[model samples]
Target: MPPLVKLVLIVVIVIAAVVIWGRVMGRRDPDREIVGLTDAVRAKVSREISAGHKINAIKIYREATGAPLADAKRAVDHWFVPGQGPGVRDAAASYTAGRLTDEGRARISELILAGRREDAMALYAEATGAGSAEAQAIIRTWDTSQHY
Candidate 1:
């Protein structure tokens, strides 16, 4: 075969290969990406239970999206407190629960179940401000129990 003919054939083959690859990949829609069944169900559940504030909304959103860390402090800080929001109590509960490892969940549970909602909420606020993970954990656990 002539050298020019050989070169042209090679170019054509390369072009054809490129075209075929593009066709196969092009058929895939980026927007059609799928979430797992569990995630989808969780998202649906979260949507069913929306919050009034952006923070709680985000917590629900992150929970649905399977966020790695709850970062209750971020959520609490961002949450809108009307005179005081639930974050206050949540923070207090978190603080009490975190500091008193000896007291354990039972003490925090007692605080939460104490029927003194305002006091518990205040304690939570203090604890959250102090950046206490224990407090956040307590709130998270409490919220989970209530939700579940």
Candidate 2:
């Protein structure tokens, strides 16, 4: 076989191995991701909560674990104790749960109309602290006709 052919065959094998590995790793295992959360992420979540940015906290948690907003909220609500660090306080409990409000959806639509789907998803996730999957769902279901 020619050198070029050997190179092509090697590339194909590498790509196939990567795809197979990704598929096997993509299987749902909520506990697996959560358990893998680094202490730095936990500390950041704690700091965000203390700063009265509960939505941000959930966003960080969701990004780190791919967990749903509800799970992230619950984890933040239960894990960190107040007064141990910056922005920690009892008032953190008063923060509302993350959800894409009507206004948020509208803003995302506007972003999409601007041909910024990635920005739209990022803004939606930041504003609502939704998981990546949920944010994608919102983008997928957006009524494009409304943009016209």
Predicted structure with the largest TM-score when compared to the true one: 2
Model 2 residue runs over 4 Å out of place are 1-35, 82-148
In model 1, where is the ten-residue run with the lowest total lDDT? 139-148
Can you write out model 2's per-residue Cα lDDT over 39-64, one digit (the tens) per residue? Answer: 46765676686677888988888778
Worst 10 residues of 2 by lDDT: 87-96
TM-score of each: 0.23, 0.33
Clashing pairs in 2: 50-87
lDDT of 1 by residue, 1-148 (tens): 9999999999999999999897555433455433432523433333333333545545454444433234433543453322233433333344455643433434445666666544554465453453443344334334323321
User: Model 2 Cα displacement at 12 (Å)?
Assistant: 44
